[model samples]
Target: INIIIQNQTMIAQMPHAADLNDVMSAIEAMRIQEESSYQCPDYLSKSEEDGSALPVNEECRRKMAEWCYQVVDYCKFSRETVAIAMSLIDRYLASNQGREALANRKLFQLAAMTSLYSAVKVHEPEAMEPKTIAGLSRGAYNEDQVTAMELEVLGAIGWRMNPPTPLAFVHHCLALLPDGSMSMSDREAILEIAKFQTELAVHDYSFVHIDASKIALAAV
Candidate 1:
């Protein structure tokens, strides 16, 4: 299912992936990824099974990511939005000051919702609004709260919004293989499997700090 199925108008249009790929050189793509790769969240210092080191446990974080997935699926927003949102959440929570904030579950959920809101607002602006995101919280939060959290989260991440994604890395790596190396049918099958690994990495918290390039390489 395509995450974005917009009704285009004369004012603007979504460029096809092919249209975009044609303009960008692979060297430039890798360079951009190199610049942005440091923006990824730190390896979670604590785990659920371990004696507590941080208030934000891994399971809770995992659940938050899943909820984001559910919301994006319902809204027909790109599933990649969840990855982006979770990246924001993780980067924020991994901070010294933010460590205390994660101790509060309500604040965490509000932050979670806000992160999702921020992602959709950035990537799928027409799909949702802060008011709608607040409503989805079942009255636990209001529009003001969501908006504030969005600002706070963005501030926490130093306004570096374009985090590298595993899928993007996968695409670049796949393109490196010569077309003659594999039959079209076999190439398609391999691509599907490789893409699936990237999806799994996106959902699994252990993969958070791993480089997107590393994940992509492992996937293939």
Candidate 2:
């Protein structure tokens, strides 16, 4: 928990009216935007073992997601980056289903890496370049290929990079709790638990379509 908590010095801050208002506004916006653009493809429509129609089936999706998590973990980026990257991949795939351009495994890998690169660029303070991502690909992809795929993914998703992730909802919901309702340490403990659940949820394709707010509340 401490490792990921960022600031270990817990300065207990009380929730104010403006703070609550901002959260409420953000939550409402997230709910609206979620339905409008962020909803992922249905897990119920999972392809068969052979991945007949789509090369990027649920198994492939989970593997990519897990790989994203590994990259963020190794790079010490927020675990939420994995959630955001996965969301980008999902929303792009949802927009273009079974398209021949994305029907190849090699192309799928490019899309996955480019999604992670784009997410990091948008959300992380230290942005990762296409070449860095290419190096991580271990010669499977080159910088130019990654650069091209980044543009394709960005355009596919309408450049809406910041989707409300489960972790974001978790933090916002936790803020809504009455101040001093519990010891800061206890609150941190609960957060640690919920964070673990959300991270696991990100890896499982089953939860991709489920609303992030619902998943966050359930995890809490």
Candidate 3:
């Protein structure tokens, strides 16, 4: 209850257009300046090279990603949450090399749920309970398992959950658009379309190797 109230308060206090413009401008500038440094290696392609050992193939990844999207939608979480969860899953798999434990179907499901749970905690003030997350997994994972995997994933990623997602870059680029290029309504319409495209990009395995900023621009 308190957490929900806090979230609502935060939303209510969001900055107006003028302040948002300034913040987005700064983000856009920083993104451009550090674009080269932000290149995440082709983790998906590398994972495929060791596919015989990893067990989780492209089809498995696609199913889990779809499940994550469904869970996020059912829970009314933002698309950003799903994107972050996908990012963590990819990074964890890539960083751990041939950890055969992830090959287990049950363990893989738990990892997916845990990644979503972690993203929720970071991106939502009022997070779903561990039991709720486990329930959504259709009993493949219990609350305790979900809790444990959450810690494991956090450690695996070295607690770096703040990767720059395509959505972030999209907003930054949208802010950088010329002021007189379009009316406010037109700009909002473009943002809506871009965001929808970004959501599609998030689940597609083909886009996994692409840079986030490039994906953002492409979506726009």
Q: Give the range where candidate 2 is weakest over 10 consecutive residues by summed lDDT.
A: 1-10
Could you say which candidate leads in TM-score? Answer: 2
**RMSD to the native, candidate 2?**
6.0
Model 2 lDDT tens row, 38-154: 877673364443364665666887888889888988999788888889888877766654244347778888888889888877677667877788899899998889887888888
lDDT of 3 by residue, 177-204 (tens): 6568789898888878988898888777
Residue range 43-113, candidate 1, lDDT tens digits: 35543234445556678887888788888788776777777778778778776546656678888888888
Worst 10 residues of 1 by lDDT: 7-16
lDDT for each of the candidates?
A: 0.68, 0.77, 0.69
TM-score of 3: 0.81
Better of 1 and 2 by lDDT: 2
Those runs of model 3 whose alpha carbons end farther than 4 Å from true positions after fitting are 1-25, 28-40, 48-51
Q: For candidate 2, list the clashing residue pairs, or say none.
A: none
Query: lDDT, candidate 1, residue 56?
Result: 60
Task: In angstroms, give how far residue 177 of model 2 lies from its true place.
Answer: 0.9
